[model samples]
Target: MTISAEEAARRPLVSDEQIEDRVADLIGRAIKRKWWILFLDENGVQLPMIVPVDGAPLVPDEAATEHSIEGLRVIMDEIGAAEVILVWERPTGSTVTLPDRVWASSMARAARDRGIRVRAQLISHRTGVRWFAPDDYEGHLEAS
Candidate 1:
């Protein structure tokens, strides 16, 4: 027996959890490359998530004083917390970038299901020098 194109087109939709899981896997890889991945909630609130990436080799302990990669992340954490504490600085790029909106949508959906009001925004990761980078949110409000 042969399957028809019309029948093939009727395949069932994938579960949201499946999609989210796949994204998590790929995103995990992306972050490990020292790339910044941002997170936003439903209410447009931004949160920074550090991909499990390590920065480049230190040129020297003395040279380290000059380079600060903190600018890369919007949020700072160990990258394994449900509720992250942040200490992110404003980005310098001309165009404002939105990161992890899909995650926000999923989060919002989950939150709303539990009858919770929500916010959304971009999230990025930064280096931690002392104790998992304090989750102290630098700004109370997002400028953009």
Candidate 2:
């Protein structure tokens, strides 16, 4: 089933602040583990590029204007075989809304085209709180 951003905003769940906290905690964990963290602007250009998983902002605090597939594809082309592209997806409002299956599939295909393995994850505010596989937009994340 398709869930628009508007629909997700109205759902009963954790407050936006709590979601941010969760996301931050997740990002911190990834960084502490020394995994690679990537930050992308709305246009899909890497702001700081992929850095050592240090405590850093994987996603900016400001709202994203958009996450275009074209931009993602471009970034994917530059990825190396030994690298993993962690696509940080910011949740819309208080909910996480990923692109539809077709868009996601295309995004995944773009990464594979360059032999780069990509992982779609949610990250924003006070870090990466959750990790998701390429095709794992299962549903809205509920509050813990």
Candidate 3:
């Protein structure tokens, strides 16, 4: 079951925990591998639009990552978004893998390069949702 845009817009995803819970509710327990972007207003309230990048590679390609981020930037600007929260959804275990780190780093770098602020990075797996801390992608930054 999916949530209505109105309901999503009413919620303020200000904290990491709120973002994680909202993402978990959005994707649910069963899901395919994909990337989800939760757009937030300047006040940290969620926007009605949630962008999903389907069929993305676990180990993202540099060019593709940049292109995707550029597209997202356009959308953000059009919608007056102030920030975005990235969610990596996959039907796997909760353990953070190398590919996860790479994806997180790539997404973060691409967004940063485009002058987009990322509120938080998260991963939703079989067990639950978990945050991608700075440490999670520090080493993978160079590789990305």
Candidate 4:
């Protein structure tokens, strides 16, 4: 259900300390899950090598095109990765927005093309927490 602005405002505010603890906990969980973290470069055309969850920060590229499946596909191919896990970073307390359905499709296509696997996760930078992918988000949210 869509919540009105007033209703959203009525929710309790989260404190910075809470956010930090949450983020740390989420990262710990991700590590336990054995999921590697990667950061998209400024061009959004490239990605750093995957690292352990505790290795380093996984910052999302702000300069990346909103629709960058093709670029991601190329990276996936070049790396010959067995699996691709997308990490989306959003400001604290903000709702998570899933990637374009096309993005997910493209990831799947890349996996098929390379005989690999693909997955994704959302990270709230503000709360330093990770959230489950949106349950109701359907195919590419953005128009191609």
Candidate 5:
């Protein structure tokens, strides 16, 4: 079925209310998961301790706005050869996206240059989600 452009435009194109709701959902997951994330920025995965970080801006990442790559692809690269990626709960969570994708993209490029294998993650705050890494998580970043 072909909907008219006018009708399509009328559709909510990511409203603040929607964004807030989405972010809130992520926050709930973060709390429930206990946030043992692999914080993959354009710079690759950061230290685990820094993954759960609530504040401290990440430079309004340019990668966050990227449109070429898919989140699942980025995730697969991080998983490497692992059969099970021993991650925090809700393993299907993939909010690391465009306009928010830049950070991870930059870190990913950085990791590529540095030849560092990484596993990055996102942590949402009142402002927005930030990056973190399981390597920096320390002391069993996960509950299990």
Candidate 6:
């Protein structure tokens, strides 16, 4: 169920449900761990420059996350993206875990620190893509 970036960009991803469905289609049963960055236009339409961060850790490390955030800022600025949606794709079960919470928390904090607007933080597991509920990441928001 994979789709090209051009095709994906043509679709409006304004809602969490739309984002989840599109991410699920793009990821299509992940075979490895990765982080995907979806930059959106001011109207919430996705841009064609989808970035897949290969070799991301199952449990993201602080240094790597910081570096990635810096990179994201540069890319967003270059393309004048209004917002970003992050998707952590992993070849694991669908049930949310501590690592998932931590990842979401870390990304939220990093984006906030950089003044980057994150539309959503999602997880694409073996089963499908889903948003990270506030409760899933609230506790870990201040962690580290």
Most accurate candidate by TM-score: 3
The global Cα lDDT (0 to 1) of model 4 is 0.40
Model 3 alpha-carbon miss at residue 89, Å: 0.8
Rank list by TM-score = 3, 6, 4, 2, 5, 1
TM-score of each: 0.21, 0.33, 0.89, 0.40, 0.28, 0.87
Compared with the true structure, the alpha-carbon lDDT of candidate 5 equals: 0.34
lDDT of 5 by residue, 71-121 (tens): 333554554421111122232344443323334445445444445443333
- Give lDDT per model, in order: 0.28, 0.38, 0.82, 0.40, 0.34, 0.82
Please give, for residues 1-144, the per-residue lDDT of candidate 1 as tens digits.
333434323432134332233233323212232222333333222333333324533121323212322322223223322232121122232222232222233333343444433222233332211111112222211322
Give lDDT: candidate 2, residue 111.
50
Where does candidate 2 stray beyond 4 Å?
1-81, 91-95, 100-104, 123-128, 137-144
RMSD of each: 16.6, 15.9, 2.0, 15.2, 15.5, 2.0
| lDDT of each residue in 1-144, candidate 3, tens digit only | 456778777877767787777877887563788888888999888898888888777687888788888888999999999998888888899888888888788878877777899889888888878887878886586754
Name model 3 segments beyond 4 Å from true.
1-4
Error of 6 at 12 (Å): 2.4
Least lDDT summed over 10 consecutive residues: which range in candidate 3? 23-32
